[model samples]
Target: MNGRSPRWTVGGPDLDLADPHFYTDPRHHGIWRAARDAHPVAWTESARTGGFWSVTTHAEGSAVLRNPQVFVSGLGMRLGADPRGVEAAAGRMLVVSDGAAHRRLRSAHQSWFNGRAVAALLPVLRRQVDARLGELLARGGPFDAVAELAEWMPTWVLFEMMDIPGPDRDELAGIMARAFDDADESAAGAAGRTAAHTEIFAYFAGLLDDRRDCPGRDIVSSLATAEAHGRPFTDDEVLLNCDGLMNGGLETTPHAVSGALLALARRPDAWRLLKQDPGLLDTAVEEVLRWTSPALHAMRTAAEDTTLGGARIRRGDRVVVWLPSCNHDERVFPDPDAFEIGRRPNPHLGFGGGPHYCVGSTLARAEVRCLLEALLRHVKSIEVTGDAPRRPSNFLRGLQRLEVELVPEAGNGRGAGADGEEDVHVHEAHEHVRATGDAAGDAA
Candidate 1:
């Protein structure tokens, strides 16, 4: 409402989202390569949200997060949106909060995701992943792995962790998806989000009360009765944490699960290799997280003036640490674009860095590993029927829908991933800029 219009920018200043070249065209790799090289920290003026400094390098990204005081997360992660959306989402408890409150809130849930803590929840994780795989097999042939693995898989896992009980798990999953879509810039989007938040919050509020009276072996119970600052968590805090867990855990894992399937589908050799040595699952999981690079960017506004990548960032200026882009930075990764299962010393920024690295990173690793083991154990091969569609957001990155042929492990090698596509293993596809100002568009 304030600006002239959503001023579109690109290597070609005339471009906008409506350009079919971006939508129909798949290889925007050139654009990303350009942004990284020509201007590691590129800026584009606003038609709407003014401008944002995109940090496409690894070292700069690390700096953005290492000093939270300088690159604050609470200013709102998705570059610029309505102030009302940010305020409406106040009390939300994920990585967005800063300082003492953030440190304290993070500690409260520390036990829930600690190595020992997550390992304890493994048995349940195994059962759920296995059951889901069987359902995938019986359902047969063509199936939306995104629906099964990405969406339902993590939902069930998080549900069990939160002690969500029976059918409400599905409700919570729907609500969480709605929460992301609720970020849409429309009254309807806001209304849907409000209702979804109210329902899930109310549901958790009641459970928190019940847990307070009769504690159980669930995370909600842990938080409801938790007392760190000489008091119980405020009602809003409790609900935000629950919703945050559901949203963060749910969207992230599914992206990896489904993205891995897509990645492996593209490389049958990798899929076949996985079949022969399931021991490689652990490495495979890390590589999957790196290759897919879900949860695209995390925001941090400068708390004070600082220098990053030779740019003077003044206090209050907004800077975004691009996660997936860093994963593909040629300087850090020999071949940043290619998905290498054997990527040694593969310290990708997929989970982020510094004190703000995904608190649930370990849990996410275990959850994804569990799902992979189950899928690899039963399913022999996977094939995609058409081009995979990515979600439309600059923040969260994952598939919207992925059609997959769940060929049985016994699949007589029929209909395998095409010729050159036979999953060869020569790693390293690094990125470079084309010396023009092209943007990879916001992939959330």
Candidate 2:
């Protein structure tokens, strides 16, 4: 809440939004609450990432997102910025592009990510959810939900959508996960990051070549053949946009589901209610998105001298909008901290908003809803078996490990550890498939 510019307030209690420590601990909430109450648009100076404004309140954060013209993304939408410069080839990606370019790129893939598109994929997603959950339930107790189920859900779905082969899919997933999770700035870290990017870009470049020769029904091929703003997308634009979709598809919804599982385990009453009435999943999914707010914050550069939440913002200043704070804004939701499954009119900024809103919103909702429906229908109870380790990432609030003991419902149970007859055949089949995949991936 200091009145002094960030330059003068360097050694003060400057909020470093890019720090992974705040995300893994409880201190982030208190800091954001103070920002919301006293300095919704506070200045923060970090030696690593330089100075930026912290936009914490719901109204002001939403305002910054909606008014993309005033708060631009072209300078790079990430903290520490994009070290390679914003105008680099990959800068044309959907997350950092603005104005006409943004619209054009988004429009190219809009049809594949709309509500109808997701609805069409409902059967496929449900089967995937059931298969994964069933395998986890059969394994008995104390399972890491992230490694066993949450992480696999979106990777399978996204791979299917993009027409990536099974062997390559797992490798690419590992590469992308490492690239995003590695926020280190050391020389070795930089080299590793560059190698990952090189591998990914080279991989996609091959896909682009294939698509150019023979376009298919998949997303990448569609993008290759599609036009944006009266001309076909350049190779660089295609590569960046494809990479952007992969990152977006992989990260957000899975973490939200893991959070929801933790929430349900803590509140048995909410779990019981959802179990009784499965139709409440739509509202329940919205509440989970709000409660988790996985994509923690997004950066925007001020396009002109402006004011936000009563604080003056100068042109060229970096503004980080804290989505978690906005979702928990007291002014918007009553009992904002409580995990209310039936929360209505939850206008959360979890998937962001306005022109740059996540195009994967529809798919994310469908994926989360499928998981909830599967959990409600199959499991009788979910108890926390051990400590749930949170992933250390400033931008992503994910669970690294969530050990849960799941009790299956009557008649549907089929395992020695559970209260039913053992299904050795199904368990062995799942293991075989898993082993095969692991071997193939290792060989690659």
Highest lDDT, which number?
Answer: 2
The per-residue C-alpha lDDT of model 2 at residue 262 equals 94
Please, what are the lDDT tens digits per residue for candidate 1 over residues 1-444?
223222223457744322212422345556656667776665545444556566778878878877776777777766544566566554356566777777667767776666655665565566666666666676677777788667876776577667677767667677778877623655786678778777878888888888889986567876777875676787678877887787778878788888888999999888778878887887888899988788777777778877777666667777877777787889988977777776777878888876667878877898778877776767777789866887765556778789888766674332221233211210000011111112221111
Cα lDDT listed for each candidate: 0.69, 0.77
Candidate 2 achieves a global lDDT of 0.77
C-alpha lDDT of residue 381 in model 2:
94
lDDT of 1 at 267: 92
**Predicted structure 1: clash tally:** 14
Locate the minimum summed-lDDT window of 10 residues in model 2. Answer: 435-444
After superposition, the stretches of candidate 1 with alpha carbons farther than 4 Å from their true spots are 1-10, 14-25, 80-92, 182-185, 411-444
